[model samples]
Target: MAVVTTAVRSGLLFPLFLLSIDASFQRKSGTKTQNIGSFWNGSTGRSERGTELSCCALINVQMRQVFPIHAQQTRPKKECRDRLVQYNDQLDAVLGELEHHPEILLRAVVADGQYAKDLFVETVTGHGFALISKLQRNANLNYVYDGPDQQRRGPKRKHDGKVTFADLSRFDVVNESAAERILTQVVWGVRWKRLLRVVVIQVLDHHGQVIKYAVLFSTDITMSASEVVALYRSRFEIEYVFRDGKQFLGLQDAQMRTQQALESHWNLTLLVMNLARLEALRANNGAQTLVFGVEDLKRRAYNALFAQVILVNLGLEARFEELIANPSGPLNFGLKAA
Candidate 1:
């Protein structure tokens, strides 16, 4: 039987997945479908050069989702006077609908900086459990630790202001797996960045050269040696969804002027992508290998569907002209998931 079982559970419809495993199960050489749950939050620019006001649900930590939110143009254009509200209100409703069903345990939430509100944080925490999130990061994070003597030191008199990426980078340790010295390097500064932290995990590979295991996170959890690595690695799957959605899913080709249309279309696309993933998984005899990478998805789905065809064609025309004059090689349009 597959060790990783994904299920939707309880009245919460909370997208819960189970991964309870025994040692005997691991010893056997069988396929294990680990329950993948992630709350992916982020925003996208409505237009290539327009405001990035789009954010929505992501599956398996995938960044491929659409918001059913709408807003009106209310600034700069005195002639086009209107009241603009973010689509977050609608996205919140969608999440609320999903939250009622408690099957989804590992909720992967995605939102922009503005969505990091106090109420949002409380709502998610009310469930008594949920993994790390992009919601408000340093609100009262200075509260004391509460693990056993073997873990935390209980409550303290005061908090250490707020832990910054810079402070964490200075700390390092020898990993248990390969006994390599792992270092956490800060990529973004708290004062300068909204997310407060963005670090990368690096270690010397078989060769002495430093290798980036993955980009680190912004959570305040007491990261164990393996936890840091796990968090970083988890981000890759989300990125895959983004790349595939944009390239094959035609996420960037949206032309809807009103926000509601934009949001509904976006949500539909993600739903379609998930269904396709399920279809592909079944077709492959239950092997979890992702055959549909970003490139494949673009050619098969986005290119076949979405309206960015004219724009993409025009962009390629300009590139082709440039290549003819100063050819280097095929330009790498997309690679990283984020």
Candidate 2:
């Protein structure tokens, strides 16, 4: 299924893609798609020049399927008459729509570290939604007082001494999971300001040696640590969508110079991706498989088109079945149901 938001950026349909492709491919390989422009860097946290787009997606955890719901390109600063439009502003706008809309009911808003600012937390909380995001490895955190308030004081103490990641064992562990590696979660506050639920995962090698560590947190302090970890892990669904679009769906292939042309090309590319996935899923009884990727969809589409053309030109009505049959050669388009 596919849906677009009514509130587009600057009265234009949101551009789902914004990035530069090497024109060198056209010179060497005679590639057709090429669009060059100086766009901001949103995919990677850098101050370099590149096209950056803000995308909002809905992930159905039960089905493990993600659908891009809304997308908008980050316009240049000069284009805005007033102050600059920051990426966080675009996020807040997208999230605000998800909050008050009658059709959609998102439980929590999950984002990466880029949207982990205090202002972002406040904005999301104001809309009555929890924000789940990752914290830097050396994030400054402090312990909050859970006991009764002090009797004599101008203001009750809200925080205690600083917290050290190395001393996690001393703190109360709210949840723990035993798998290939051990995961421990605890309720902690960040920046000594906001109360949050944090999960600390310790990755270990086969020899039982500590190899790596990951820290995730949630603004919804009432949520369980396990739930926080689960939501944070599911945040990668949007990344997979981008990867599929760029790899197989002509996401990075478009020859345009104007902003309008680029916007149309980007939106169309993502729209095609959505349609292909929906068609493939429907064809397979709504089941998803790792083997049945976008490549399979393209192959099937090509064969279907070829079959139609042959039937039209040669007037071979009886040979239509044989032409549409699954190719048994090296390029097989048969459905490998999972």
Candidate 3:
């Protein structure tokens, strides 16, 4: 229940277009461990074979505020004494919270390949939200038949053939590299039980040979292929949040043992992130176009605290926020002596 139960912004509320959620792991290695479990630490690009707390954080599309709504310590299958819970169950809890609050107006959920499974897709869609994520490179997809059928058939043609890069046709070209080495395709994903829209982006060498490609899809087939690619691309916003939280905000700095302590520390870090944003926005007079950031807010806070100490020692009755907002202004250090 750490979810934000109140509106984040003021005036002319807009529909929340995208909500990006992903798990962040804290690497832990110690003698005494309680709820610690081995989890994937993406920052290291390798499996963290030690105890880690898998935290799920949700971010607004514009990177306005990030909320760590749910977190559970990952438990290794062999060491787990009780039933092991997956990200899907935690994500369901998050979606369920949003469902009760219609004012949030969440339209779609954006995540990485980790959440591209059928269970996650069905769970997200069940909450009336579209799932935007990438499919594995070797995904088993088949083209559904829409062509004229032959009378001689038993189960009928469920698939045209195995879909490969060479045989796929591009319905529309979404992007082209300046060097003419990359092409993005938006086409119907054939061969799957459910009709889906897929985006195939291929990078070719100078010889026009396929070097790399990405296949992104959306459960809400009505969305254009371009929209699918864009939404999936925005999923990285949460990744950036994790990076900032770790590097600047000390997201992975805690070393608590109990579940309550671990959860509290994780939630507190995310709460600080949101509070910094809220403070920054207020500092900018609620202007979304401003360039204020969390670091800047931290810097201002440091100055404000220093100025408050100085003002209190001098028996001054002036506002410390003015000094914080404009440290070099006349009111801060230029005030006339009594």
Off by over 4 Å in 2: 1-49, 75-85, 148-155, 171-192, 287-292, 303-338
Number of the top-ranking candidate, with lDDT as the measure: 3
For model 2, where is the 10-residue window of minimal lDDT?
19-28
Best by TM-score: 3
Q: lDDT tens digits, residues 227-312, model 1?
A: 44544344334445455566676664665544455545555655556656544445444433444453543444443333245546
Give the higher-lDDT candidate: 1 or 3: 3
Alpha carbon deviation, residue 66, candidate 3 (Å): 3.3
Pairs clashing in candidate 3? Answer: 142-190, 142-191, 143-190, 143-191, 144-191
Relative to the true structure, how large is the alpha-carbon lDDT of every model? Answer: 0.37, 0.58, 0.63
RMSD of each: 16.4, 7.6, 5.7
Q: Score candidate 1 by lDDT.
A: 0.37
- Model 1 is weakest, by summed lDDT over 10 consecutive residues, at 19-28
Of candidates 3 and 2, the better by TM-score: 3
lDDT of 3 by residue, 135-168 (tens): 8877766655567787995876665655565656
TM-score, cand. 3: 0.79
